[model samples]
Target: MSAVRRLAGFICLLALLAGAVLWITRESARPRESYQEIGLRWLRDEYRLDDATFEKVAALHHAYFATCSQMCRQIKEATRPLLMQTRRQPLSTSTKAGLRQQEQKLCDDCELAAKKHLLQVADLMPEEQRQRFLDDMLSTLETQRLQHDLDMSAHTRR
Candidate 1:
């Protein structure tokens, strides 16, 4: 019937619109670069680091990234069970507490690794540039941390 055809067309049009909106939302939410990439780029531009210094910094960055990536995977693996348990049934208080502690420890380890890497990079910088580099790097880290926390909170709310 003509009415049925019209109804089907309307539904298809609505579906297309919904898909477009979802695509736009996801694209907007995506970051242009990883935080580490952004930090490295910022350091290169802001400090005008020499080639040798840049190479050393890059090496440290790469090493730290590897460690961080491993930590992230471990955390994700650990959290998966907790998430599954929470979804399937109520978890015991002790189990929940243990999971939270493990998560916190993983986060702390990652933070410590980053701090050590930053210190190594700072040591490589000239005395004159060291303070400036630290100031800029700390600011960048704080901004990124705040943004990450905000994003996590928003995600959890959903």
Candidate 2:
């Protein structure tokens, strides 16, 4: 009877451990919020935007996200071949320069798109809030761009 009780206790502990592992795995696999969602939420909270304003902001964001996604896909498709080629062999100096130029152009286009979207959003705000919105959004965007540049430079050095 004592052996039977010990066996039951062990099984319960194993079950609890399995449950914990499963919960952790699910939590880790959950999708994180996209940049657009986070930006919208921050704007709403920071500005105390009303429902109508938020709706307009959200609509603008959704449209911009579609454009941004398309541009990113185009950039990725354009660059994939270059990346694959580089993986196989050393690129000629001219070829590497051309690739870098192409990538910079894509990056510039993305930045322009983001700036346009942010400006449009700022336009939706009241007179007093417009500058604040632009300042905050642009600051956040610039910070992200700088971090991205640093990370890319680090990756290339590796």
Candidate 3:
């Protein structure tokens, strides 16, 4: 009787352990939401947006982000050659200047696109929330842009 009880308890323990491991594995594999989604949710909650408005906002948000992501990839690709060039040998002053100019152009274009997207998103928000949203976003964007500019300038100098 004791052996039978011990065997039953052992089997149950193994079953429980297996179930836990499976659950953990499944959870680890689950997809996570992007920061864009989190921003959309914040807009909905903070702006007190209706479902219909939220749907429009979400569509615009996603479309803008898709384009934004593509541009980011392009920027990364553009920088790769510059990075490789520097790693292999020192560049001539003019060559370095040209590469830096190309990078600056890409960064400027991205900033413009982001500003345009912010304007479009603000247009969809409530009248009261529109300026506030822009203020919050543009201020944050400006700060980040300035910081990035500073970092790039410092990087180039070094």
| Model with the higher TM-score, candidate 1 or 2 | 2
Query: Whole-model Cα lDDT per candidate?
Result: 0.77, 0.82, 0.85
lDDT for predicted candidate 1 compared with the true structure: 0.77
Backbone clash count for every predicted candidate, in the order shown:
0, 0, 0
Q: Best candidate, lDDT-wise?
A: 3
Instruction: For model 3, state the Cα shift of residue 1 in Å.
Output: 12
lDDT of each residue in 119-156, candidate 3, tens digit only: 99888888998998899999999998899778666655
User: Who wins the TM-score comparison?
Assistant: 3
Give the clashing pairs for model 3: none
List the pairs of residues colliding in candidate 2. none
Using lDDT as the measure, what is the rank order of every candidate, best first?
Answer: 3, 2, 1
Candidate 2 or 3, higher lDDT?
Answer: 3
- Error at 89, model 1, angstroms: 1.7
Q: Can you give the TM-score per candidate against the true fold? A: 0.61, 0.68, 0.82
**Tens-place lDDT digits, model 1, residues 1-158:** 69999999999999999999999999999979878788788887777888899889988998888998998898787566555664446667787768757866786776677677777899998888888878876787677657745754443333
